[model samples]
Target: MRDIHIQAIRVHQYGGPGELKLEEIPPPVAGPGQVLINITATGVNPVDWKMREGMLARPLPFIPGVEASGVVIALGEGVTHLKVGQAVYGSVDGSYTACAAADASRIFPKPVHLSFEQAAAAGGAKIAWSALFEEGRLTKGQRVLIHAGAGGVGHLAVQLAYHAGAYVIATAGEENIDFVASLGADEVIDYKAAPFETQTGQADLILDTVGGDTLERSYQLVKSGGTLVSIAGKPDEAKAAAAGIRAVWSGAKSVRAMQEVARLLDRGLITPAVRKVFAPLSAAAAAQEYSRLGGPGRGKVVLLIE
Candidate 1:
């Protein structure tokens, strides 16, 4: 048997980013339906911090990180389509590490023209696209409102909706209006200056990424019989029934959805924005700063593994 050593960030107890411990461990092996990847870059999402703090439900002794881009090094039995040395991107367990063993179903071949950083950003954007375009059934020419338009998911949602022929309205902090607009949003509202519900009246679809009041307010902005799809919060089913609107909380993790994202990425219809890059050793500090910033841009904070 061959042995390899790789570095990963692990958390024994959940709290703040300060709790992350960097350690070296044996490189992961591919199991049935799995593939080992030499991770080049990993995209950091809000969920990483949430999971780290135990706010999200996950098993303990967790290795945090969601999205990554890398090259396939090994494949498990039954995995015949993907070959070693092929560039691929996907969501995986413990993406912060130098090497990751991911379910082959969650992986996709990376676009030849895209850099590793861009592919990393695509990981989170693809989930957003699946939620808004696939499950939400967003249509062209309809008015769609996306919360946090400059965010990893929101930015892509804006572009996808625009490409789909929707009149895209997006909300973001004042500093991000231009960035959101550049992503093809028709109207950019400053979320702090005025509530999104107040700025954009009834819409055909409302994509909510911020929960709590933001999620609640979204209901009021959707026209009667309109749909409110949330990736961050659970909608009020009772309220939706009363208002004649459909509300749902959607998550994207299926193999098919990941493949769809890969297709879009390969076509250059969508791209990931990278905001910052940090060494694997600085992952804890990066997480701390990310949480502090509240995740500002569509740009992804990445840990460069290689």
Candidate 2:
């Protein structure tokens, strides 16, 4: 019941980047099992823009942001794992703000070696890891292909797949072939230059981030009994059944998945790639730019609070 105010970006009506408005709102209070975070940096996801434009299903007048890095300012009753002043980062409530209140379960200690920008990028890395390793059931010695190899999730997925002892293949623009290769991709296919299905076939697992035609093409590359996991599109179950392959669609908002990501990051086994940083007030403009420059090696776009 303390009086505090913080700057935030809010969307009253869903539309394009121009819809986002920056204004002052009451600083969030730590509720039961929640922690108040003083956000330092927030990551911009494609979903954030989609959510803002009413593309993804959500309530109106919502604060839009998913991943962020910050310090804990307060803890709710029954919270014990975190303390005030601890540097932490995660995808939490309305991340486009100077302060936030998030479930304690979703927060994790920021990696000691990562900067605030890097931590903001790490948010997508965790999701990629969970969708690929945990849900996709990726195994060592398997052949894996990741679409958009230089994207926020794709780059990390490439590294994680390679680190897991998989023969990793990645699809990106010709310009990003070397970047994906440096992340340990055994082969890099230029999706723009050639059809991925024609270049790489019989993948044991496929991590599909780009939906529609990309998803349809991915199904052709997975071997029988293989799994195809998508974060952006719903898997065509009928198509999978016909091809004798398994398909999974990932939904965000899993606490367990977030914790798993934090562990991997803390161990320094995986890292996020950050391409640019924008001030919080400029998040809308940044999102427009990110959408325009869609490709590999562009990395994650982040909004800095301070």
Candidate 3:
């Protein structure tokens, strides 16, 4: 049989957006317990640029993209829950292509109400869910602070925390305070207006999406016995111990988390905000650059494959 080739964005040598090259490559096959998907859209994430810039190393000449939304075209052996032609969305390796094969366990049925772009953007919800509930152990009536509340993960985290009955306090710039509040935040602190530590009260949990100084400042904000969860990097154990608080690093990609997020989406309980859309695969580099510069908050950047 003749091999089928698809146009994809490839990074041969890590450097910058320039490394993202559109090329003709053989499409990945659906291996055991995998599903071949015709990718409709891909979510642009910081990891995409980090991998391209060598911060996160991968094999040379590999495709870049972690999550996407698309239709299943073929199913690998032993996969029974999904069928070909089913619309699904999930984390997939090399999603910056027209077609990519994903592990069957990771992908879930796309919510019917969401556009392909919206589904792609919601990929960050898994991280948000894990951070807010799994790592932070947030509970109803407890105070939870979400840093960067208008960001891709933060926005979702804010809504999830709020709907779960937690007192959701969020940090954002002056521009996004209202936007974050609209998403169910009980309070939105304009971080630029004042030091967040000074403006916010002690919280039962803090979800740190912005690391470095933000994470450093959050230790004092959490009440004793409270938890601080960071997705950007590992939290300092000594600082956490000294503060009498629990600190956790959240980066787990759980299928169960994704499934729960999907249910939320289908029920209109949580909405994914897509900030920008670039098309035709060739725009992968530009999309990454946009995301790197922090494309409009309260959403994610998406790449629409032609």
* Ranked candidates, highest TM-score first: 3, 2, 1
Worst 10 residues of 3 by lDDT: 291-300
Model 2 residue 78 CA deviation (Å) reads 1.2
Candidate 3, residues 1-306: lDDT per residue as tens digits? 987799999999989788999999977889999999999999999999999999987989899999999999999999999999999999999999999999999998887899999999998789999888888878899999999998989999998998899999999998898999999999999998899999979999999999999999999999999999999878999989999999999998777888889889889999988888999799998999999998665589999997
Q: What range of 10 consecutive residues in model 1 has the weakest lDDT sum?
A: 280-289
Best first by lDDT, ranked: 3, 2, 1
Q: Given candidate 1, what's the lDDT at residue 215?
A: 93
Give model 2's clash tally.
Answer: 1
TM-score, cand. 2 vs. native: 0.94
Q: What is the C-alpha lDDT of each candidate?
A: 0.82, 0.85, 0.91
The backbone clash count of each candidate, in order, is 0, 1, 1
RMSD of each: 1.9, 1.9, 1.2
Q: Report the C-alpha displacement of residue 138, candidate 3, in angstroms.
A: 0.8
Total clashes, candidate 1? 0
| Tens digits of lDDT, candidate 2, 80-134 | 9999999999878688888999988888988889999899888777778778877
Output the better candidate (1/2) by lDDT. Answer: 2
Q: TM-score of every model?
A: 0.94, 0.94, 0.97
CA RMSD (A), model 1 = 1.9
